[model samples]
Target: MPKGVVRKALEGFQPYVPGEQPPDGEGWIKLNTNESPLPPSPKVIAAIKEAATDALRLYPSPTAAPAREAIARKFQLDPTRVTVGNGGDELIELCFRAFAGAGDTVAFPTPTYPLFEPLCRLHEAAPSRHPTEAFAELPPSLGPDPSPLKFIVNPNSPTGALFEARDVEAAVAASSGVVAIDEAYVDFAPRSAVDLLNTHDNVLLLRTFSKSYGLAGMRIGFALGSPDLIEALDAVKDSYNVDRLAIVAAAVAIGDDQHHRKVVDEVVKNRTELADALERRGFEVVPSAANFVFVRPPKPAAEVVAALRERKVLVRHYDREPIAGWIRVTVGTREQHEKLLGALKEIL
Candidate 1:
């Protein structure tokens, strides 16, 4: 195929690049991606192993019915109000498919999930970017923009700062378009925006099993919203967006509340220690409510990350303005923290 064969919308497209995922068993301390240091619940593992049988020849449930029901029970919502996806990323894209279109406007705060901007290009949707000062609050102009779709990444990524629930609700209440509140990191945050669904019909709260559930490899997630919104997503989604194994993992993961709490509690505890260590080392640590800490190192951000990488330590580095000179390190186990701290001490 010729280069010109590509769509005009993505003539020179730049896709979203995830954090460094070096090959496994390579001795790298992977604190770049926010994965739970602990393994998934034993129950989820048992369920996956149990479901992986002759059923492999058959397609999984198209609607991911069992997982939807499980999520509904946890959230105390009707099954019609829930929808499962391959991951939270898929649910985000579904919102674009169901609402925004070519030449349409899609609004979101900046320094959020990098995938949003790339999706805008792929969909030919004009991006209405509202810049935030240090990941503080929802942009005021976002609500009044009247874009067909808007996204608020609560406990926004990279920076790991959780926005106030009232501020998020205010944005949803004021917006004339569909508002997708991405709570992928909400499990580690102090509050959630799920309550907004009751007061506003246009709000959708997206979640994932990848983080707290320790199922990143499973790649499963879900959304909670009015039946109308869920129905729209179901309409645009693939015949079987959530696969058999992933669906099984999601169902059991949501049902194991004890294991879920353990994951969150561990991350929260590790988060405080990681933040304090960074600050004591002269890094300006931003207040974090997510599973990661964002900080401006005393040394150049790029240099620090490169040095750490040389030591088989991985942490995310940012170079764009407003967040330039900043690094985001996921909260890991105490042993991993000591390794990271040692590596940083040598580097700094």
Candidate 2:
């Protein structure tokens, strides 16, 4: 391990920072990561248990056909147009590998997903950032000439701001290269860009079982696009990316629409209640379309975060400009929300 052996491209690379996960048995109210508060469908649990048998002695299907087919059936897409992955994060990296090359630029809006830039750096691709207050509008600079590989996180993370389907369609129509819409939180939004799939071949819609399906621990996600883009992703991804248990769980979860809808409804209800409560406390709460809300308290964000931690309630705080003063809170169950609000009341 010599210092000079490191790649020059990674000279100043900064890794993505995920939300903090406190240790188990810490008696902490976890509301940092945007995981569903509800558990997965009983059918999903049964499927996972059934899959955890002697069958694991064999390799999983490299193509992940069953899970892909289940996702396609859910979205009314062809099996050839779906690609499953270990998680949405892996799918993002696959997009970078399949489409971007050295010196090519990968573009995404700032204050969106934190992983996009790091993935671009990992691929030795130049990173281009478009600054936006909220993700309600597309960057005017995105078009055919520069032709960068673009990633858009609908109902964006941290901010929880959502862009309309028409805005996404406009971006796809104008882009020369690929346009990937990370719909990881679209289950809680009013509409999805999947409706534009038939008309746009350049758009890739990414979904995860982690959010609404309550399969975050399973680490299963999928992407939908034209057959060509899906083929490219399949070719670049690691073989046997989705394990047997994860595949079975995701398939069952996707097929259980009633369970998924009920969880999403509950999250949406809690989100509204939490936002209203925050606003009533003299905090400026941004309207959220996802399962989290971004709020700017009267005090500095770092101090507020520390205070919350002291009270054994955890939320997320970023150290970036324009958003450093804001904290992102995931909407948990009603009891969790009550605990969070009570903590905030004391802190404020």
Query: Which candidate has the highest TM-score of all?
Result: 1
What 10-residue stretch in candidate 1 is worst by lDDT? 1-10
Where is model 2 poorest over a 10-residue stretch in terms of lDDT? Answer: 139-148
Q: How does model 2 fare in lDDT?
A: 0.88
Off by over 4 Å in 2: 1-5, 133-135
Candidate 2, 254: how far from true, in Å? 0.2
lDDT of each: 0.91, 0.88
- 157-209: candidate 2 lDDT, tens digit per residue: 87898876676777789888899999999999998888778998989999999
Candidate 1 lDDT by residue in tens digits, 1-348: 236988766788988889888888988899998988999999999999999999889999999999999999999999999999988999999999999989999999988888999999989998999988658677787778889899999899878888877788778888988999999999999889878888999999999998999999999999999999999999999998989999989989999999999999999999999999999999998899899999999999999999999999999898988788999999999999999999998988
In lDDT terms, which candidate is top?
A: 1
